[model samples]
Target: MANRLTPQQQEFYRENGYLVVEGVLSREEALAYRDEMHALAERLRAQRTVNATWPSIRAKNPNVHIDHCHDVQFHSAMVSRLIVDERFTGLAEGILGPNVQLHHTKMFIKPPAKGAPFPMHQDYPYFPHEKHTMMAAIFYFDDCPIEKGCFRVIPGSHKLGPLEHQSPADHYLPEDKYRLEDALPLPGKAGDVIFFNYLTIHGSGQNESSEARTTLLVQMRDPTDCPTVQTHESRGQGMMLAGIDPNARIRPVWEKE
Candidate 1:
């Protein structure tokens, strides 16, 4: 596969802890994925899959809502193919070295006018890895402007490593120190994708616009990078996105010795 990211782009990611690439997918492809996401949301709702809106947000504003589903590829074949596509995996390899492993995939739909907001926080508290190689890629299926609560990040915050966070259950930074309004917003067009380190301090505001904000987030890490804790394990966690998993081992649960 061709190099999906240029040298300057890689350097920027290293220095800023986040990088945005435009047109990772074609406009038509993005629209198709967006439609698939909407269909999947309906199916999940029919199945009574729980709402993923943060409890904190609901507490503050009962009217706000955010719909989400984990392991999206399991629900949609198109997503399964997209995850393995060179356009996606090649970019993962460019940042995570040759052996890239998927941690999980989540589909999020922020409804118009009452979309939930995420408080500033680092992803480290959820699932920390020994090598700290875990990162996420957010693919925009529709235009995400600031008013639509596009993602925000604090540049170079990853270099601070894991900082103190609130309760593991709440998982947010101190409001007095890291306010959502202070973070740098990253507005993106359809087909754009943003990659950021897991430790990067980030969040987003509520979607105050009339249009919904749809996105697919994929968390990935080097296969050799071991998790510090066993939390956030998912069915598709160890799937290789690029190259081979050098740390593959037979589990006793699967095959008794």
Candidate 2:
């Protein structure tokens, strides 16, 4: 039960808006999650419920594909346990303090050759919170190199707060201003995780490698922080990951009996 992140790491995160921690999960653990993800994808595919491409990406290039599933814990028990695991939650606590709550979880599988690329943008447009405490931890299930479309970010971008996105419905920064080429690529090996604030401007390139890049992204926030907009609500949204929810309150009932 030691501190998962050091003072230096915390400082880097606060200053640069992101931090990459290696060996968060062991090799064996990462492999297990990767296998489970593929299995789940197969199951969802059979049911014709798996949409392997995003609409925006498709509009740009029909060949490119990036398979994804939201609320992944609801589909896999292993993932459900992973969200609350102290090793992971410890990182959340380090950033958001003791009382951490789950915002949502998502799994992304960037296929080889034709993986979709995400344009640089802030997560605030999707789900804006009052305290700006919302952050994400992306768990790499396999080695992710620059060629594999590894995550990229603009250091200190979070300090700029929420910038104007291109479209309210479809979130992205203007390509002319925030070019992907200008961002720093953060290549990571299996078991590594990258944590960044919601206001940080980030994106990734297409996976042109032979292998797929699989990752699980978990969004967390301080329980006391309230959302500015009621959006992106998930079945497991309010679940506490670490410590107690200080903002919890009993709901009032209307006497109709």
Candidate 3:
């Protein structure tokens, strides 16, 4: 992958806590992933699977739909391939390091109109590590305009090292809690990828578009560091996508991934 960041680009990420790499995937490739996910989502719907919801992020209403497929790498082969793809690995190495392991993959499909916004929060709080090497790579499968609730991030917030986020109790800080005069809106097209720091303060607005805003989030971390508390069944783990796990141990859930 010739997509390695230049010194300036790397420095920008270091100083801003977030960077967007345009055209990380081709339009056809992004469409392919979207097709697979839509099919999977239908299957889940047929099985009567309920998606995880935000109980209090909404400013207007409650019980809005915010669809998600957790640990998608375990359920979909195409997603697993994307998680270990050399392009994403390069982005991770550019920021975190050369040696990184896949923590998990999640698919966020925010539907039109009724989709709720995610409250302002740092990703590090949910999955804190000993060294805070965790990073997130989000690939947009659909065009993300402001109408679709594009990601809004605070520059250099990662350096703040996790602020007091107590909005919904043990979750996120409400968007209204901060002034956000400096928040940067990152509107993306299909195939764009955003790599961000785990401690970065970020969130999205309500989806006002007619189409769903789809994104695939791959969380990667340095293997030497483990999560302070495992939130999901295998939140801290899965099959290592890059380098060897320095703190490898026998766990039954790991083999399942």
Q: Point to the candidate with the largest TM-score.
A: 1
Cα lDDT of candidate 3 equals 0.78
How high is each candidate's TM-score?
Answer: 0.96, 0.94, 0.90
Best by lDDT: 1
Worst 10 residues of 2 by lDDT: 248-257
Better of 1 and 3 by TM-score: 1
Off by over 4 Å in 2: 1-3, 52-54, 251-257
TM-score-based ranking? 1, 2, 3
Model 3 regions more than 4 Å off: 58-60, 167-170, 179-182, 233-238, 248-257
Candidate 2 vs. true structure, TM-score: 0.94
Q: How many residue pairs clash in each candidate at the backbone level?
A: 0, 0, 0
lDDT of 2 by residue, 1-257 (tens): 53378889989999999999999899899989999998888887787755456456677898887778889999999999988889888987888998888888999999899888888999998989889999999999999999999999999999999899886556889889999999999999899989999999999999999998999999998888888766777777888888987755552111113
Instruction: Give the candidates in order of lDDT, highest first.
Output: 1, 2, 3
Comparison by lDDT, 1 against 2, better one: 1
